[model samples]
Target: MKITRVYAAVLALTSLLFINCSKGDDDNGGNPPVQETPTIEGTWKVVTNNYFEDSKYFVINEDNTLHIFYEDNLGFKDTQNANYTNNEEELQLTINFGYGSLLANYTVSSDDLVLNFPDGSISLTKETTALAPDNWIKTLKIINEGNAPWTERIDIAWNGSQLVIGNGYEAEAIGLVNPETFALEGTITTSRHAFAVEIENYDDEEKYIFQSDNGSNKFHMYDLADNTHEDESLPLGSWIYGLASIDYQTIWASSNNEDSIYLYDYDSKTIVQTIDLGERSPNGLDYQAGYLYICANGQLYKCDVSDGLEVIESYTLPDYSITGVAYDGSYFWVYAEKNNEGKLVQLDLSI
Candidate 1:
């Protein structure tokens, strides 16, 4: 009887061990842990202290398309489109307004995303709401058009009291233009083609005109008092396209071939800073107040000085190609050829 009772106990213990093993398999072996999918396809916004830069919103779609929207305080809006590709590890963007093809290391959390750029890193947050598109080009209009010298390239600059236009690109003169009527009244014969021109006045006694010839890769200074070329012809080793005065001793020059703008000091004969615009070639340049206006790819861009000279706003026009731009005290002017005739026109910027 004792042997039979021991056998029953052993059989009962084996049955219990089998049941525990099966339950362990069902709980741990048969089922695996679930994982979350990774993604960054959503509308995002960058919050910044700058009033203009803070208004940028980036909308990323699942179809690998990206749209950047900008709106100012006055409700004027603009849009830029580009292609983007994002893996879990990296993000890539095609050509943009200020940057070229860019590859940035990225990290995305539940609602926050950060991208490391070459210059710096930017943080963005996912936005649940999307912005409505209102293109600003629809409101842009030319206020006036007037006769300009027959030249392939035209650059204009505000010379204190009037506008001086350059008949550049193989043409050899700087035409004195009446700002009110936009009429070419007189001309100053130049030894070489004046690709770009800027005027600087320190006092009534100190005034000069700066000129650049395209192939020379150098710029010459002329005293406005005597119209004589000064010995200070600065060479920057790159083709210069545009010139804008920053101060009496400093100026900015743009090289379309190098896609850079150089802040050069004529007195020191040194380059203070070289700003790279990536693939965007700066064709024409003008400085007003604390902002810089640039013409590139037939579009007008306004860059803020407080924000590292980054592009804050852009203006575009249909059926118009801008070769050069200038800002008078009250309005902006551009040199363009419409209907097969080269003309200088005042642009309305109220939008």
Candidate 2:
């Protein structure tokens, strides 16, 4: 009887082990989810290749033409043109140019881009892809904020389906307007005089930002998930004129009365790096197509973020006081105000 019991116990233990292994192997039942590869038709700055210190950039377009600009260490600049073909299915690229044809393989995961060549591999970082600078054409006029006329130093941002508007002249509230018709939806009141209003969208919720003048905590964060304003003690400084972010934590802000962009650390709540905007006052910024487009000096300046926020392109707007700017995937909406009256303008952008 004892031997029989021992045999049954060993068999049960083996069965349990087999069941556990089977459950582990089929956790997802089949293949895991796959993320889509982002579009790669844009400008890329060479981060690493054969040349270590030389500045190199390539404008890869959908028209089979690649515009190359290179600056050597001796301050010599060269402009080269080449024709290229790509096979997205096979991830292969062939360049036909002056001397001969060179074949390469490329892959883009998230924002990092890699081009593998026959001679050597080139790792490029995206500045702005599939964005044309010259294609920004004005698309009629937009209406005004419904509740009241916009005060001075008006700022604009997009939060989900609405445009959040703020101003520096009033210590009232942040106005939410329809992005299409500019009709007022609602308002989120604040006790501080707000200058910049921006939102950081996460997976499930959004964190709204209401920034003020150079007084105290310059900005206050409001989370949509809990519907509360974190104003007990903000760990940041003042004079934060503009705010934007491609990612949630790496918040980039422009200072008031200064042509400066500061990378704000969320945890530390301090300026991580201060980059010179090369202008007197860089205000009202939005991060679009890997560039920080700032409404400053009566124009929209595209800063090459991959090159230390250097102004690469500027689009002249009307002579009115332009307060804020926002990008809505296909078009750029700018806030132009004069004497408390505001007008939203849509711009069609191209390269």
Candidate 3:
């Protein structure tokens, strides 16, 4: 009678185990599969181009219209109108002015996107935060170095507390001074013939320095790490009067003669891209926030460098012979030579 009771208990335990296994399989069937997120709609801007150090800052409207603002390396702004359309996988943008439309394949990766053009390509990264207010105020104070006669074209770059000013046309040293008091911090005379056209802090360890002859078509690169300049020089095809470094590896140089902007790769020592601005000679160039601001033929233009190099918006300046341009977070600063005195005008860009 005890052996019979033991067999009956064993059968009961096996029946319970089979029921639990069946319930586990049914639970697995109830789970759902994951789905891909939809592509972002509405207009977008090309805030940065990693391929070409140039930026095309533009806007896309829901109505399929596109606006472009572009500046050559020479500080000339070229404004053009166009239309654009995208189907998530492919994008077709047509610039109505001169050059034909640009067709490319586009891909989205997480929050970042890449557009592959026929000749080259551009990548776009979303902005984490909105830009600060445009409220830049400039106080210009002339400094006299006696008989030395301060460099004609001085490029200014702010480094947190102080501003570094560089002299053009083979100036030996870069001047560091207080932005408010204009007090001299000291001079950096590492390069023997430092044209000091543009100075930019690329990373924690290095700063990029560009210099070119006023008449010649060659530009020099100086690495601030070892305070040494490169042996090889970059050819601009035409005389490079103005330049700006987008990053440590790329530079945008403007040719006054050709009326064009050329993008150069500092790492590989090659010309990667070029934008023809026609007869308008580019004078000064600056990359503010994510837009490439150019002063060309008395106009200001901005481009979306990440969105297939599209021009987005532009405004004509009162003075056509603008010399240089700078953006101090908010306002667009224009330097022009009118009459005998040089004039620095501030333009409001709050809109």
Candidate 4:
């Protein structure tokens, strides 16, 4: 899934790839202690993130399993359960979070433990208190549901008071709802499925609404200032399943049947970067600061934008079908739809 590097930084980063930790003195009935893999089982807390601190934690148990836990501000709990294999060097984590096993460069140095991703890295500290065994991942709570039976993608945007949602499959409408009360505002139809919607006010006339489609693979840029549209389709060359605006000029989109995401520069009217994700069907992407959280295959991935779309952390929603994700500084707004039933949940990342 590697593509030709267009930037020098990406070319230089080809050196930091994770190597198999199984490199040690051959072990037999007479294995030396110096070549044996050290124990990495214990508790680790997230130490660095652009948005929040101490919000994420993981417990790597010696029982060949690991638990990643998240507690939101509202007391809702979310977690990931995965099987792990530590080959005396690297921990091959088989996160049932969709994409199966992920090889992370593991290094434990005193107070800090680092797991390097393909392009980015995550630093976890030794937790002062080990979490209780019974205190593993908890069941999620449903906060709100869309008024209309949402049949398509459930990508949402926050515009201060209300959440503007993209409408149904091949939708001819866009919906607005209060995030707090789930009160529905009047929906306006436009004869296109707003499969993915992004809210941006980047020094424009006012806030603008950007839509990425599932059917036409086009972009419908609507100016909220004048209630007019600059509807145009770009050569996506694939089906776009989601959209997220990075700024006024740049927006990111996810493609289905392809493992890569496309960086569309609306100002330039061209595809800037076609990010290659080795995993298939990159869907429902949202950008905040330097990270992009994407929902695909029931897994939520936190990706670093500086490098080649490297996944820093991936959390899987086992048994649950989560479709989209959005990060708004404090919390990660997660969405799920089943049988035309739409539900939105808020995860307080500050917690």
Candidate 5:
């Protein structure tokens, strides 16, 4: 009887140990399998093709939202937003532009994302992030040119309530019909070519103009209040092709022949700094916010004028020559000389 009892106790202990071991395995089994949902969430770059040779990029959010950015063959950068979805293998994206919806497809690979469009397919490598969009307000073209058409193009600037325009040879003033309308008000003729125009700092009550001749080594300044031009010039030793005001007292000018930018103090009329922008022919300069924007050889560039005039970013256009550039607080307006058409392009600056 004693032997049987001992055997029974050992059997019961063994059963308990087996039960505990089974429970421990059930509670803490090796990590469960990692299940992946059929979702593509991240940024994607668009492949280069005939229509978009410069390469476009896009971003996809977790909630099915999408943003597409590309530069058209015309050298214009454009951006559009929409929604996207993926079903196991194929991806479908739709962009609604009020006028219509644009549909596109994509096939994802291990290291590549290819966009399949109606025309052809574009393959893009998987990148860490998409490119930022361009910060453009609006583009205003000197369309009518005060009803008097001229052979050469003119640059424009704003001085309080007046609109100032400068041709290579003269500076003209116009009255603002509204914020967008310009009517011929007055004209100031200069002996030298007025390549660029800017409002001088500390002279908000008056207008100071910088005029540069084609081959002249110096740039001249004129005062609208006194109706007199100063003989003093900023000797760049090269042609002053374009001019823009950084602020009320600071001005920046670009030289095509020298391939440099000269920053001058308006009060002292002296050179403060200079920036060499490589070998590109720089022209049509305008300043907005904190950037010095210039159109050179059909491409657009933005540089920081305050510090050392470092190039922050650059973009290319399909066409190679732009006559003039203007910003209406929002978008970058470019006049295509090759096509003889005005293009108001929106740039996406999202990083």
Candidate 6:
């Protein structure tokens, strides 16, 4: 009786051990671990080609919605609202347009993104959405606050000493402003309407101011020695909005009507090169070192000096209309208008 009882106990213990082992095996093999999906929620700057398609970017939100900006066939800036579904391996975009759905294989790293489509892949860098530093300090109030027309202050240039301003409403003279006091110390009397002013200071002996005539599609050159126009005028087919001088032989002029910058040969009095700014209306232009700083659409753009003139950097300014930009060795003097008030703002290179 005792041996039978012991044998029963051993069998019960063996059954319990076997049941637990089976449960462990089932837990190990019954299901696999799930993987977390990769996230694609950020603003991305498109850098597929060497030149930046400024109109092209992606703004993906957390709610599966996105905004894609691009230039249409009509050369107009356009945006598309879309819903996006992203996984670890694929991304699907459902645009509001007639196109139903488009899929692409994508990869995301720390700061880089690559979307592989049927044709090719588009490369993008994650854009930092941090607001620009508040480094712009207003130094002068050039225009009063009210319903003043934008033509009150048009352009500005740093002449190594004072600020030469173009008063678009005034047809007879350009004002020479004292940068220190923000006062209209003197005026350069000329017959041409001053819409844009640039100083071509080859040397102390040969300093001249180039002004774009607002009354007509033309430009005039005035000698600073006597503040005289010398009757030197050139026919500009389009409305020239800004001018910048490189040397005694080269000058750059921006045309708002044509959305292009013309490289004029001062000696030949002819346009040697034309840089097309693809749909961007350039307002003002200034040159420093080898880069061209452009004021377009209330922002400042820095472009290279090469043939392509690829935009290297872009800075967002205050919520004001940027009319002109000038670099004065240390600070950047910007002519901005807001609430019908125009001012000369001084900003450091931090922007």
lDDT of 2 by residue, 1-351 (tens): 999999999999999999888876776435575567675578887888873245477778888888666554322233456889988899888888969888888898656778887667888888844423233323233333333346566667877677777756663667887765667778876666677777773444555464554444456666655547863224443466677866766677777555566777665665677776443566788887677777765556666777555656556544455668876656677777655566666666632
RMSD of each: 12.9, 19.9, 16.4, 20.8, 10.5, 8.3
Expressed as tens digits, the lDDT of each residue in 26-61 for candidate 1 is: 777457756676467787787542322524777777
Q: After superposition, how far is residue 307 of candidate 1 from its true place, in Å?
A: 6.3
Give candidate 6 regions above 4 Å deviation.
1-55, 62-153, 170-172, 231-233
Clashing residue pair totals per candidate (backbone < 3 A): 0, 12, 25, 0, 20, 0
Model 2: CA > 4 A from native:
1-148, 213-217, 231-238, 338-340
Q: Each prediction's Cα lDDT score?
A: 0.71, 0.65, 0.56, 0.65, 0.58, 0.68
The segments of candidate 4 whose C-alpha lies over 4 angstroms from its true place after superposition are 1-151, 201-205, 231-233, 317-319, 338-340
Reference-based TM-score of each model: 0.62, 0.54, 0.49, 0.58, 0.51, 0.65
Error of 2 at 247 (Å): 1.3
Model 3: worst 10 consecutive residues (lDDT sum): 130-139
Q: Write the per-residue lDDT of candidate 6 for residues 1-351, one digit (tens) a residue.
A: 999999999999999999888977877545665555445678877878333244367777888777666542323333456776766433544333346666667778768877776665678888888211221122232322222223454778987777778877744567776666677777787666677889884876767888887745567777878877643445554667788888886878888888888878767778788878777888778888888888877767677866557766656554667778787777777777777677666666632
Candidate 2 weakest lDDT stretch, 10 residues: 131-140
Which model scores highest in TM-score?
6
Clashing pairs in 6: none
Give the per-residue lDDT of model 5 (tens digit) for 34-132.
Answer: 555433466666656654445477666777776666543333344566765555444675555567665668666655766677776666666674444
Superposed by TM-score, candidate 4 places the C-alpha of residue 99 at a distance from the truth, in angstroms, of: 18
